[model samples]
Target: MSDITVTTEDGKTSVCSPYDTTFVSKAKTIGGRWNGPAKAWQFDARDENRVRDLLREVYGTDGSPTDDSDLVTVRVRLADHEVSYRDGADAKFAGRRIATRPGRDSDVRLAANVVLIAGKLPSTGGSMRYPQINAGDDVIVEVRDIPRATLSLEREGSYEIVGETRGEVDVDALLTEREQLLARLAEIDALLPEPEGTETTTQEAAKALGVSVRTVQRWAATGKVEARKNDQGRWIITITI
Candidate 1:
């Protein structure tokens, strides 16, 4: 950084600082601007006090002195929020405002738009919840490159979700589906016909008859279910569900 000069000429006060990125940046923090000819950093001439104060801080109290006379206030639109401070009506333009309103604050408004700023949409997907805005907050938005057609917020985008994820599949959902598949397979296996001499177990017969194992065993002992023990040492019975 270097020294800043203050001058008053042609009934206009102008503050100038060396044209450098770093110096121009710090100058702007105190409301200085680069609107003058030759690209010098300049700001409100009436801001002599503030300008001197900033220069003093940068170059110490030995910095150049400035003259004080007719004071002026320069107003620039930095951003907009409340109805009173806002400059123009965005409603006059054709576009859409898609986002949830904050229950507590009006500064931020966010819906189900993919957060592609860092180079991706939403990491996860779900339903659209409440608004995400707060009062006095500035939302940094950039224009998406739509080379051909006009771009409007009303149009669907890769950044926002217009609906829910009812049609999507996740891990837990796959597990549930697998369980259903296994149950269906078991049912189909149970329905297969047996070979000519094959028979069902006492328990299988009970399951077919919708009776208890003890009841099936008692019936088999009373010759109710045709039963035999196979060479494999398993109980067998003649029954059909």
Candidate 2:
């Protein structure tokens, strides 16, 4: 028998455990908020993995709470595809099952009851990665932890699941990558030895210089105006007057 109990209420994972300094410390470190009313530590359901790990550490095994009471059921509207979750699929990432059974209906609603994890992984560049869905209608996705999850809709094409699986963002990795990029950028900027001038976008420069955007582009291309592309490959012009 496990000394800890894990349950879900109001979209939050509630963990009731015996008073252990180690468990309390680790739980607080993992952002578990104390709930006075329930006498349990409440956490974002997406952090279920971390909570389970803690349980495994303090207790010899993951908490014995296997009741559906611990599961959080959320409704997701899928367009052009139906999603079905297999029992015990949430045990491991590789074991996750998102079976899509498409039908004649334009939209299908599925209740993701046993889903503890959701959302796309972060990109290599440390920016957010938005999973593309079918663009017929706004598809509401279930992001387990946070209140909001960003997803994009591709126009005119059906969305393919491919080998993609939902996972939480590695915030530490993203922050470290961002810092390294910024430092490298600073070094590159220093090496360029270019004088900092009034930096503005092509559109803004065009409006300021009272010229057409095409004229601005022409000027930039011919070196008639000092302009360069930013990280996003957008034209940034150093304009006078």
Model 2 error, position 121 (Å): 56
Off by over 4 Å in 1: 1-4, 10-12, 19-22, 61-241
- The root-mean-square deviation over C-alpha atoms between each candidate and the true structure, in angstroms, is 30.3, 20.8
Candidate 2, 1-241: lDDT as tens digits: 2235676546688898655456778899989988899899999976776897876665434444222113222324333332213211111111111222222222222223223133332221111232222223344344232111111212223322222233455566557646755865786778876565798988898999999999998999899999998899888899754
Score residue 206 of candidate 1 by CA lDDT. 77
Model 2 Cα shift for residue 52 (angstroms)? 0.4
Please tell me which predicted candidate would have the highest TM-score against the true structure. 2
Poorest 10 consecutive residues of model 2 by lDDT? 87-96
Number of backbone collisions per candidate, in order? 13, 0
Best by lDDT: 2
Tell me the lDDT of model 1 at 124. 25
Q: Compared with the true structure, what per-residue lDDT tens digits does model 1 show for residues 1-241?
A: 1134555445344655432333456777867766646445455655555666654443332123111111111111112212221221111001122232333233333322212132222222222343222222233332221111112212233223222212223456447646755865796679988645447787777777899989887887788767877798666787544
